[model samples]
Target: MTPLPTTERRPLSDRTFGFLLTLPALVLFGAIVFYPLVGSLTTSLFEQSLVQPGREFVGLDNFRAVLDDQFWPVLWNTLVFTGLGTIAPFLIGFALALALNTRLPGRALLRGAFLFPWVIPGVVVSFAWLWIFNANYGLLNGILFRLGLIAEPVSWLGDPDTAMYAVIVAKTWASFPWIMVMLLAGLQTVPGVLHEAAGMDGAGVLRRFWHVTLPHLRGIIGIVILLEIIWNFQHFDTIYVLTGGGPAGATTTFAVAVYDTAFKGFDLGRAGALGALWLVLLLVLVVVYVRFAEREEQS
Candidate 1:
């Protein structure tokens, strides 16, 4: 009798196996993110209400109305908030990262302490800052009055001129630690030989940092700033808690505007339209960030 031949089983390719592993995550993302996104887009094309049962197709009227009504001011406020929120935290975090990168006492403890603000829940942070900026008997006002910086307590969140800045301060406080952690990690990756060489070449601290340190950190810095901008663009908790979109609509960013339009005004269509525009802005930033990240990886 002839011996029977056996067939060998082939293993799955790496790409296929990886896809199989990620399939659940992909399905979850589509269900959670893509589903709502599609719903929002569809809703933008129709006039609908949260309370009412009927809906009417309005085409682009919602977008046109949003553009005609307070859109410019809201867009301006969002830009200001995003710009300041990103820059202020980045500067503070960079400075802290540099300082903490040295051989200092209690460095580990200090790093942990610095992360407190970032780890705190946004709602709690918002309320804490709200008290700090309160018109009467607030920490900030008390300090200013004691130091003779002001004759009286200042209503930081109640003034249109200062409301946005007050919220930005809170945001900066909460955001900087993340930046610090990232930059600190980047700093650790900077070669010691480069610094030693730069120093031996008569390069001062500032010069070394500008030429050597900064170049090493340029990629990380760009990525961090982009992430910050994207986060701040959608930040609603701190601003809403601190200013409630303000004394004169001065702090009405896209996030707050969308919330107010949908919940407070009960105009789902307009809210969806505003949200659609906001999504476009965020998508642009995301695309830029993805390209930048890919370029960084390739280089």
Candidate 2:
């Protein structure tokens, strides 16, 4: 073969150098992401415990046990947590973002103060909510008592019926600021000229928003929802601190289940299987999100 010119060879060399530059990141990903993933898969195929001397390969037994056990309820609870957590934050945040998008007095201060919940650590927020939900001597009960709304304090977190909701409320408070920031950015990108034109055409505020604002914010909204789903599915710290999967496993999300299995239950095989299941679920969500996002963009 004829030798390539030096100039052509230089381009190839530059491309090779760029690839070489990215090699470190690839190695890091393999070590951090792939290595653990493969390890988890192998662990899932075994009957292993932290206290055991060695792992015993059991094929799909671990997966079958996870599927046939009380995990279904926990899985359902996780779905509920993810759905409510994502929706409540998005709705409240979008509403707040819309209200704040207009020129208003002290808007900057309000926005900054509203973000306090988001900046607080999850454990801190959980403890704060725990205090508020205390059956007696809590702020909520105190206010309700003062207002004569109830004759006695309510056990917000003690009742299985209300525990999940209590946790959801706390999660919502911690998460809404993120959606607020995202929606605020989306609102800013919405063309003011479009709104003005819509108004000139006799479109009302709602009409203008529906016709112009929403369409413009669609991409951002999709991104926010996708991220929320992912984050909410993996949420553990707040639930752990607040409820610890109680007052009777009402708030036991999949992440909490994985934690309990690995640490508390000392079942390495079950934990690894659960972790792999979560990974698969998240991967499916990501794929669906990308597909829907692409469809939205095309439309």
Candidate 3:
């Protein structure tokens, strides 16, 4: 057989060197990522206690306990919180992105200000909301009292009816900025000529947006929804700091429940089970996103 050409030899040599260059990073990622993942899975199969020296293998008993107890309610609450939180932020953020994408004055300043909520840490936002929900001297109640909206200050975080809503509002404030930035980036990719062409065809503003802008934004919206779902499902800090899953366990989301079980209740076994359950849910979401992304790629 004829020997390979010099060009082919050089390309193969370069590819080998590139792989060698990336080997360290690949090894580090596996150690940092897969190692913990496998460790967690192994831990989930056993009855472990943070206070104990050894873990007992319990197979599926821990999982069974999780399913039979208040886990169902916590799961339902998590779904509700994630769903509503994701939807509200997407709508509000998309609206804000649309508004800011216009040729309005001081648009840059407004866009920068829009990022303030996202720039603030989740803990800080939670504390701010906690103060706002304070019954006596909170900014919200003070304003309402001054406006004669109520004869007395309302217990925003003290009542089961309003506790979840208060947390949701605070979460929305912190999360909408991410969706706004993503949607704004997507909006910039849309050709202005499409809008001009639609206008020339006598399409109204609403019609143009619906027919032209939305199609271009579909992929970004899908990504935003998926990311929001994942983030909202695992959200703990805001809810923990704001309500501590209080007012009759109204806001006991899965993450909060996991923390309460492991730390407060001292049931590491149950906590591991809860973590495994969330891992399954997150895996399902990942599969869904992968399928959608594959479809988009094919289209």
Candidate 4:
């Protein structure tokens, strides 16, 4: 009998083959992310003027200057906006998710309607809210005036005390729908049998939610909250359009500060420094997210 011919195989090892498969993505990441990151870090070490020809080596002076002058107030604004933006939307989304998770009339339509804010462009959302919060002819003041809630038009975006809150409200409106969608997906994964068992044991609605619902949703909750915080920390468009970082910089988060420093202030070095610090904070959150995701996958 003739021996069967053996098929020849390529010389590449499995690991090598896998690396080759990922090479394109790695190259893309290098170009789009790593290169710019390195550029920003390098620029942070120098003083460069947009109008001038040369960059001066300043070491960490750029960082020192930012830290000593504008950093604290800006950081405070960022924290307030990010914190309120994240928490308010999260609560509203969670509530909506719970309400819609039940059997209800027009559930699908309601869900679609709730997603309007999330699907709209940030600029458009900013402008819509801009009109809503307008000092003169805004919907908010109009309603308030008719109801006798205010003696006069209130400038929601013009007052430092209220600008951040108004921005947060807009951010919340745009953000909650996404959170609702995520948590709603998580809610679907929950075992209905557990809920029934809890109900059979005479657990109240709030009790079952506190015990069964929350425990089941803990993983998704952490992920959504972290992701929202990261996104909010870098949020700029809403604040920019609605308040332009303020009547007095009340809404200037890190993203806005970086833009204003680079283009408006014409200080590339300081902008780079601010960006580097922003990158660090985001990196820390990313690391935590990666670890949490890994843990979730393992469990």
Candidate 5:
């Protein structure tokens, strides 16, 4: 006797189940993210002073005014700060990850030591660095004096020339551990077989790292770099606490500029306009990055 034809129905796959489970989260995001974004964009098309009773629709005037002469310096400062800030943290973090990846005495202790900077509150970090970088009698200056490296104290946060760099250093110090932890996790995911194969092929340490480890970490590095760009560009807390975008407005990025324009100047329209521009710029960058990532994945 022949058995009856068997019929089968597949259960919900993991991807579709996950998407369904996250539908509520997606709705929450639409309400929270898109709603405010739309509101801010609408606000940018008007003249809304805090002192005024009414708003006037001025079309692109707010944007035009935002792009006036003073905009260049702020934009340049933001770019430089973001570039240096991103690069320094990544380099330091990658180095830390490499160092800690190998087994050594007190390795766990060393990892925790690096994480201390990251766990501190931003305001506290700012204040701590403020004291350390003081032009007179600070630890750094005192150390320099003891070493006889400088005849005079250097005004790290006081000089416009050095203020942005100072902030970058503080931010890098605070942020590097985040990258290190992430990279270390990625390193653990790399296959040990690959390294053994490379070594068997007569590869040196540098060669194995370049060819085996780096390719394994390519996706993680790309994600980390892109995220750093977004976070560093929008970062406000440390800079706001440390410099307040001062020392001749040397550290005023788009984020700081938005705060100053909105709160200090009380020009909501202009602030909103600047914010809209910022949103557009970030969105463009994200899209380009996503396209690049997709292409890389395809290749």
Candidate 6:
């Protein structure tokens, strides 16, 4: 046999070339993500006024002020919104996903239709629900009136009591499909034999799901729920467009609060502080997820 041809490796300079290749992306990341983060953090430490003569360094006074004033309520609102917005969808979407996973008629059509709400533009969903929840000439009110459910139209989006829920309902409608799709994908990964085994043990439908299905889905569910929390925590347009944090600011989420504090209140420092706090919360969750994923992979 002929001697094997000698192989020549690429030059060590390729490492530097690879670094240069990734430099653009690093620059872009700094420009968009990291730079703004640093800017926000720096701005939060100063007393920044939108219309005053100059900025002053006030340390954490802006944060103190924010906390002293409306921060508690706003934080509560944000938490509630995040919690309900995440939970309702996770549950309903899981159910819907489970149903869709079965051998049922119109399975393909149902799956496609579930995706419809998620695919629709947020603005369109907001406006559509705005009309549906409208006090006058809205479908929900019209149907309720016809059914004799109420003597007069209810201001679903106007009332402080109902505004958040109304927005939440729209949010749920838009978001559940996302969870459904994710859970459906997670469902696919679960071995069919597990279900068959459970069935052989005479496990009922709910029992099988609770025991076999949920165990496999727990990790995915947790991740999706956390993601939903993050999304809703930063959610802006829907609540803003529909309610504008109206009726005594019942629907004011963290994102809306940040906007109001910065633009409407003209208190950039406080807004920055609030934004920084929000960022820290999100970062913690991200770190947790990354570590968990790494550990899972290692295992």
Cα lDDT for residue 188, candidate 5: 89
> Native-vs-model 3 lDDT?
0.89
lDDT of 4 by residue, 23-115 (tens): 999999999999988988898999997667889998999999989987888888898988999999999999999999999899989999999
**C-alpha lDDT of residue 247 in model 3:** 82
lDDT for position 198 in model 1: 95
Can you write out model 3's per-residue Cα lDDT over 1-299, one digit (the tens) per residue?
A: 34355585476665576679999998998999888777766776888887878888999998899999868989888998899899998899999999999999999999999999999988999988889889988999999888999898899999998888899999999999989999999999999999999999999999998999999999989988997898899999999999899888999998999889889987888888888898899899988888888887788
Assess candidate 6 and give its lDDT: 0.88
lDDT of 5: 0.88
lDDT of 6 by residue, 100-184 (tens): 8989999988899879989989999999999999999999999999999999999999899999999999999999999999999
Query: For residues 1-299, what per-residue lDDT tens digits would candidate 5 score against the true structure?
Result: 34444445536665566679989988998999988789778889999976677899999999899898446787798888889999999999999898899987887899989899999888888988999999997888899989999889999998999999999999998989999999999998999999999999999999999999999999889878888888887889999988999988988988999889988998989999888888887887788679768877887
Off by over 4 Å in 1: 1-23
Candidate scoring better on lDDT of 2 and 6: 2
Q: Deviation in angstroms for 40 in model 4? A: 0.6
Candidate 2 per-residue lDDT over residues 1-299, each given as its tens digit: 34355595476665566689999999999999999889977898888888768888888888899989857888899999999999999999999999999998999999999999999888999999999989978998899999999998899999999899899999999999989999998899988899889999999988988999998998889989998998898899999999899877888888899889989998989998888888889889889888878887788
TM-score of each: 0.93, 0.90, 0.90, 0.93, 0.87, 0.91
Model 4's C-alpha root-mean-square deviation from the true structure amounts to 3.5
Q: Extract clashing residue pairs from model 6.
A: none
- Which segments of candidate 3 are over 4 A away from where they belong? 1-17, 20-28
List lDDT for all candidates, in order.
0.93, 0.90, 0.89, 0.91, 0.88, 0.88
Best by lDDT: 1
Model 1: per-residue Cα lDDT at residue 20: 97
